[model samples]
Target: MSDNSSLLRVSNASLLPPLVDWTPPTFTPAAQARVAATMVLFVFAAISNLALLISVSRGRGRRLASHLRPLILSLASADLMMTFVVMPLDMVWNVTVQWYAGDGLCKLLCFLKLFAMQTSAFILVVISLDRHHAILRPLDSLNAHRRNRRMLLTAWILSALIASPQLFIFRTVKAESEDFTQCVTHGSFHERWQETAYNMFHFVTLYVIPLLVMSCCYTCILIEINRQLHKSQEGESLRRSGTDMIPKARMKTLKMTVIIVMSFVVCWTPYYLLGIWYWFQPDMVKVTPEYIHHLLFVFGNLNTCCDPVIYGLFTPSFRADLARCCRCRPPADSPRSLDRLSARHESDPPKAT
Candidate 1:
């Protein structure tokens, strides 16, 4: 019985010779190095963002912190989902000589992975627009409840709507290599038209329109800040001191907005450009030697990992909440305690109410 089993194993191995090619040329040293570097960066970013999320979710902070809880959780959840669901499958696809996972998994993984990615992108754009409204129109009744539950529901709905098409379009195919299979779109003239439609949807809804909205919002906020600062200069000495605080706060907000926009551009622009290039000139760029493709896959996954870090830097309340969520030491004291300290430090008599 043992001899028969061994013989069957040998026969199977012999029959599947091309499927498990392990030659050195299959993945060059430089390509491997690039993959390693990208993987390291991706892991680091993911871990950092996860830590930030944990800290915010558990820590003792202001009640207003609850307002951003949904958004933070959504971002972190998407990133975490991608790290586990997408990255491993992508790594396997890039390195293996064949598609061992079958067609069902290929379609499911491709759909879920791209859907999460698109969802994350859409969420970020929503956040930018939300911030713009809050900052520019602080007195407006709408801005008063920027953290409304309905707003979060809308964000999720929009994200889902934006990502839905990926489910139907992505497909797995057997490739030229005997052992190898890949998940690629089989775009016939009709399918190609569908691809074009989805691409335009992605471009217009996710990138172009969001960016324009962000630009307009930021512009209005900046102009408002500038006007406030100019008005501050002509005020009484005490009023000037009060107004001076606005400029500092505005500067911080501006810095955060710039960083968020820059991070979005840096992480996404290459992937989008490469995607467009591939769509138009599929033969021009070949990702051979397995590892090069691995690097590109890792690079694309990094955006989801990096978003939480951007949020942490921009929002102080978020940072404080994140610390609490992770079971970090409690903050020094409440806002009332700080007020008492300020009162003790002042020597001048109180002004008339």
Candidate 2:
């Protein structure tokens, strides 16, 4: 009987306490390692994004740079906000394992984090569609400066509006253990129902719809690329020529779009899938010890880091502006200039048919 009682105590030690009785454990060595890594990445991302923003913003008056200025600024600003503002508070929460900050701060952090995340996602979708329009319909008015600005403004306003529900749903809750406090959504059944509804709305509207739109845009873009390639090949074959040189500028754009899409898929898909899974299996799945929760939180923050890198990769105007701002000479040659040369080639008369 003594041995059996000892065994039962061992089993209880291995088991997690009930939710109502739970307190967040002190940060372990491994947790500290993870938080440190996250903060390092956040700082690096913030600096790079800020540099990119300063570069692009300085080029606002240049005619060639004007086209991408808004895009560069918007993405950089979002990333800066996410990395500097959102991630620091999150790190504090991770370190202390409690909401040492007041209720007001809890609400603000919750709102800012959700708002920035949604804004980043929406901006990515917009950038993808913008690229699709530029490539597939180069002559279209959708690329106009005034229209782009208005669209960007609209995107910002819409992202903020979408994030407003978080303010109402999240609150600083005094844990039942009475020894700790944490930020969580808490309310009666009606309030919980409202939270659930908002969660569903966010999942569907922000992630699902935008994902579908991006997918469709990329599909159309691929189809258009194929069509253009075929036409270019046919033209070459008739002239006994090999290939038309695809402008480096256009290639850069294509590469940028691909990177952006891939990054979005990599950083956010896990979070979205986990969110849905958690929402559905709130009781069946245990997130503690497994550390899936921490993993999701870290990756979700990485989207901010990835955004500016994508911008720098795809946009030559941005790169040029960045170099100029850094007091460095721009690359002597670029795809945009090659594009101009190609356009001039098109205007030249063909040999007698």
Best by lDDT: 2
lDDT of 2 by residue, 37-72 (tens): 688878879777877777555542122334445665
Distance from true position, residue 143, model 2, in Å?
5.4
How close is every model to the real structure, measured as TM-score?
A: 0.70, 0.78
lDDT of 2: 0.61
Candidate 2 lands at a TM-score of: 0.78
Task: Output the worst ten-in-a-row residue range by lDDT, candidate 2.
Answer: 1-10
Cα RMSD of predicted structure 1: 10.0
Top TM-score model: 2
Q: Model-by-model lDDT, in order?
A: 0.51, 0.61
